[model samples]
Target: MSAITAAEGNPQIEFWFEFASTYSYLAVMRIEAAAQAAGVDVVWKPFLLGPVFLSLGWNDSPFNIYPPKGRYMWRDLARLAARYGLPFRMPSQFPRNGLLAARVALVGVAEGWVAAFSRAAMLASFAEDRDIADDAVIGELLAALGLPAPEVLARAQAAENKQALRAQTERAAEIGLFGAPSFRVGEELFWGNDRLEDALAWARAGP
Candidate 1:
């Protein structure tokens, strides 16, 4: 049973991520390959930190509301990105609205392109410093993926899809998630870009 579980089990880890999150950008860039090499399946879970912040009595990204932490965050991201051989750039906008991107990512998850689309969205926002909030950016990303942007956008806006995203956010909260780039392996949770390997190891080791 243990061998079978390791070979054909459910998602070994649930990747809880938010687009506006800096650390999430790092994790997103590397998680797919790491998980594949570990022979662990991942469930990509997109969520909003807005509600989570509100629940904590904050109205915005803690990074912006607290400048010192924000400064450290940017510097830290630069160092980490360099170590990973990935590009990094500070966006003109901090925490750009990710609602549209998240919704489309939900579609990506269903259509089997969420990983690529998520990476592209992250690159647009962090590496290229583009405004992901704009529908045009997401449209271009969809078209690049050979998906019909208009139709995908339409489905993304459907009431059911909207509600599904909300439910995923709520689930994140229920799972005790407090930030992006969090990983859940069975009942164990690990957070931060630095913990990506740890999470994979834990998942690969099984419960």
Candidate 2:
């Protein structure tokens, strides 16, 4: 009965996303419908990009650290967002603290609220240009999703959820995932929102 249960018996596509990544936002918005049409199920895996970057010796978001790439990313997100018929607005903070959001997403995955929470959080951060680090925003997102705000917030702050989220990020790095919106079918890594369709195709073909 869960959204992900639709993928049962079909290949499970692991979607690794970062909260602050613009391209990831685009992927979060459209991946479900595309995967459903293709007879695949999307496993929403929200991880922190900060740890991934730190593992590679970077201190900040590639967008802020690399001016040209950062500039191009914004424009690219605008175009993609428009194409997807989704609202587009850059968050006030370039790289919002995704720790809280990612933790909550981990809980959502277990509770069958992954897809909705992911979409809402992405919209709140990217389209509404809100600060995701604030507990208030995340609390609001949980409420909007009809999930128990206190329970979800407690899970996000709990030690177990924190560790689980960190492990997911570590696993992403082990699999050579350096960006948001990356997809994996088995061990193969497909990066970017543009690569999603191809990933689904690969899923259909069975690894």
Candidate 3:
């Protein structure tokens, strides 16, 4: 079952995203308005794509391994970001380490601030070019959200919370997710930032 399976019977969409995914950064920025317009509730599910890629025999991001694709992705992202009026900049690092962010996101999710926290983290990476893997960055985001940084960071790094995040990633795999910025409306899945609107429509229509 999906990590958000419990949301069934509602006009809800499961937004499965990776912090390091360029396209996920796009989707996370505007999902709220889109979902609201479509009258769909969105459940943010943050999971690691590194494990998913490993399952497909990839040792690293396909974009990095393939120069042409990497170039195309950056170009496409710039064009799309411009179209959406969202600020975006190519980070100095490609496919950054998002483990700490993912763990902390689960804490944000439980605390009812995942949406804000997720957007801030993405902005920090794609818009501001900050190192999200740095604890200082994550701490700054938490503080902005009016959360106690030290306490939340401790909880986010707890053994149980780490295991919980791993379990969510495992569930994403079991549900047949092959990429980030994916959406699940009941059993139907949509991939890519471009499909976000379609996913919201599906959610509004129900299964």
| lDDT tens per residue, model 3, 22-123 | 999999998988888787888989999999999998889989988999999999999999999999989999889999999999998899899999999999
The count of residue-pair clashes in candidate 2 stands at 0
Clashing pairs in 3: none
> Which regions of candidate 2 fall more than 4 Å away from where they truly are?
1-8
How many steric overlaps does candidate 3 have? Answer: 0
Supply every candidate's count of residue pairs whose N, Cα or C atoms clash at under 3 angstroms. 0, 0, 0
Model 1 ranges off by over 4 Å:
1-11
TM-score of each model, in listed order: 0.94, 0.94, 0.94
Residue 182 accuracy (lDDT) in model 1: 98
Q: Between which residue pairs do clashes occur in model 2? A: none
lDDT of 2 at 84: 83
What does candidate 1's lDDT look like per residue over 21-114, in tens digits?
9999999999999999887888899889999888988899999999999999999999999999999999999888888999999988898899
Worst 10 residues of 3 by lDDT: 1-10
Model 3: residue 15 alpha-carbon error in angstroms = 0.5
Better of 1 and 2 by lDDT: 1
